[model samples]
Target: MNTEEFNNKFDEGQSMVDDLDLSKALRSEQQLTRISIDFPV
Candidate 1:
């Protein structure tokens, strides 16, 4: 594949990985918020 094609594929893959990481981070944040709310003292 050409450099342009490789760069496009690499960017796409990077975006997908970023999206996955963002979702996981949001989910964990939500869980932490819920736990904190539940255990408020």
Candidate 2:
């Protein structure tokens, strides 16, 4: 469907999961960076 149609469905709180095309969806890079911290009591 077009953008307007998609927006209407989303605005109406309808389910749009089935209308999505994720065949080439990209996976976000989630590399974690470690941090060092010291706390004094």
Candidate 3:
């Protein structure tokens, strides 16, 4: 990829990483479940 394309992708990935939230969502039973990270390296 060209420099600009690489930079754009890098910036987008950085933004997504920065915006990640690790808090568990509560159900009616109030159980804490783990979040899945499915990204491939």
Candidate 4:
């Protein structure tokens, strides 16, 4: 493939990684809320 195609693919992969990171962070926050509610402080 060409340089442009490689750069596009790399950008897409980075975007996917960012999306996955955000999803994981959200899920973690939700789980923490649930745990705090269930256990109390």
- Tell me the whole-model lDDT of each prediction, alpha carbons only: 0.56, 0.91, 0.64, 0.56
Worst 10 residues of 4 by lDDT: 27-36
Model 2, range 1-41, lDDT digits (tens) per residue? 99999999999999998998889676789668899999998
Q: Across residues 1-41, which tens digit of lDDT does each residue of candidate 3 receive?
A: 56786679787775444333547544588778899889888
Model 3 lDDT on a 0 to 1 scale: 0.64
What is candidate 1's CA lDDT for residue 8? 90
Query: What is the Cα-based lDDT of residue 23 in candidate 2?
Result: 91
Which segments of candidate 1 are over 4 A away from where they belong? 14-41
Error of 3 at 36 (Å): 47
TM-score of candidate 2 on Cα atoms, chains taken together: 0.55
Model 4 Cα lDDT, one tens digit per residue, 1-41: 56786679787775445324455355344553333346657
Worst 10-residue lDDT window, candidate 2: 24-33
Runs with alpha carbons beyond 4 Å of true place in candidate 2: 30-41
- Roughly what TM-score does model 3 have, to 2 decimal places? 0.32
lDDT digits (tens) for residues 1-41 of candidate 1: 56786679787775445324455455344553334346658
lDDT of 4 at 7: 76
Q: What lDDT is reached at residue 13 by model 4?
A: 73
TM-score of each: 0.32, 0.55, 0.32, 0.32
